[model samples]
Target: MFVVPKPLRLLAALLIVGTTSANEPIKLYMPDAPPLTLHHYVGGHGMVGDVVLTALARIGKLTHIVAEPWPRAQIRVAKGKDMLIIPLSRTPERENIYTWIAPIMELERAFFSLDEPVTSFAQARQRYRRVGVGMGTAQVGILQREGFSNEQIVQLKLGENPAHLLSLGRIDAWFTGIPEALYIWEASAYREQNLRQSPSLASTGLYLACSRDCDAQLVEQLRNAINQLEHEGVSLLLRQAYLPLQPDP
Candidate 1:
């Protein structure tokens, strides 16, 4: 019987593991949330998507991204096997639903209005009659926790422009991530002078997450790749490139 040397055995084992990881199919589900992710964006993926794609490339993994409504995407990714979701907020409500790989960005939630900004959630509840929030977003839970009623929370469908709704007096305010609000404002025909952003309501890390029963090796590979990108300042540069500069709220 021929025995392989220990060093040779180790090298072979590593190569086999690497080959398997590289061949594994990774499907990343995302919504059309601008700045963070937009299917039709110049890169065919926005900031978070860019960061995720870069990480996948570094790990020598091939992935297909599916664009779906936020609610549908979340459900699909959470239920699918070994799949991934991008730019997902790692909220307490969603903490255990998925296997969180790594945070790609920090998202600050805020209230945007055409009038004076409310100083606090308490103030917002008192002053605003109806607040617009994206359907299936963490913002909905945030507002509910802040004592907002179902009537006060208007769940807007995908492609519903909060700014447009605010301008038309449909919703008294829009509660959303700052980067997304700023990106929408820049792209819309709305005037910056008219839009008012409240002080940050909450801050959370947006992550690249896999399905609950994700492959351990795949998670490790992607996590290391993401950490490397963050260390190299690639994440920061991607954010800067996508998010527009605006005055402090």
Candidate 2:
């Protein structure tokens, strides 16, 4: 029989307690939304994904992660998978749909075009023959609210590939977030062939939306974790990756 010292026994007990406390691994879904969440050559990590994983780490063990299409991710959550979706915009309609947790990140919507220059939403509405939109996304809500009928909208999965359609003249403008839109626009082969994007159109906040199946106490714990991160400037720390826009001289 092996005999352990009192201090060793106490440490062993603490380790067991800690292990038991972190029994279940939390699932997190990250869609491919560049600069914010994208799979680059270096790795499958971005500012939003990184910040979210950091925050969630404080609350629970994160695992079983997948970077899929946003619509699929939404469906998974809707089906009550034990997971968290990052950078989701919370609307009154979505409130009943998903259990609310801490806000993970924020994003501003923008329009990228290959046709004539657009100074504003109204101008883009009138000038563009077609607009690229992500199916079942908050951007769809914005365009629908602005009176863009289904016939006028070209739906695509969530990501900057919509901008490619725009550049191909398949659509006029791609509706997307500022950081992502700009990154894709700059990187687009069409831009190399001469395509351009207008300035940002609108700004919106994004949040972490958990499955409604999540326990209330768990949700509250995650929210507190987020609050702590915010208080400690975790958001500001993440901002370091987003270098300000500097025009080519």
Candidate 3:
């Protein structure tokens, strides 16, 4: 009996099935971090969001993006098949957790202090009793790596204001990206709040991360699209809209 190999049979089946499954919209998730992801205030999303949308549109096909609070969005993207979260900080702790795409942007990881002055991460680690940060953010891991104990890290729930926490003397400082912090402060009364920018922890590149189970071919395609966008300055142009002007809060 002549036996057909399993791989050949699968190829034949796919060829017969065609590209209907491939046409399904790719689902994307993002947090409410401004400049990177402006959750629900304007233009559907912010700079990075606009960049991704433009790239995907130019690439064609997949066309859906969703914004959720970090905690819920992170969990969804990390486990959901083929789902992705954008402007994700590509950290050592997260390096292997998901499949990474091109760097959407570089963000300065910073510590913001209120009432008292903390100059650097070392000073903040040694002097501050508690540091507040949005949950499911790279800042949380960065702070943990700075030797902050679990109790020393204050996780701000979605929709809760870290600046408010700092102003109320709840947390000693806040750890987040420079643009994100500034965006929040500029759009809210927090600009004049006691919070002040402290020393930067590090400059980190943020990317779009797909679940591990995602198709590798699609990942590569998306990466190429973003690379083209960045190379051609479309991404930079999209980013320019948010500069100086307070992005839709």
| C-alpha TM-scores of all predictions | 0.88, 0.80, 0.82
Candidate 3 regions exceeding 4 Å error are 1-22, 244-249
Q: Which candidate is the best by lDDT?
A: 1
The number of the candidate with the highest TM-score is: 1
* Candidate 1 residue spans exceeding 4 A from truth: 1-24, 247-249
lDDT for each residue of candidate 2 in 103-198, tens digit (9 for 90 to 100):
666677767665555778787777766788777678888877777778677778654476567656788777777677666666666556444556
The best-first sequence of candidates by TM-score reads 1, 3, 2
Write down the lDDT that model 2 would get. 0.64
Model 1 Cα lDDT, one tens digit per residue, 160-186: 888789888999999999888888887
Candidate 3 total steric clashes: 0
Tens-place lDDT per residue, model 3, 192-249, is 6545666666888888789877888778877987887788766776676676432221
Q: How close is candidate 1 to the true structure, as a TM-score?
A: 0.88
Provide C-alpha RMSD values for all models, in order.
8.7, 8.1, 10.5
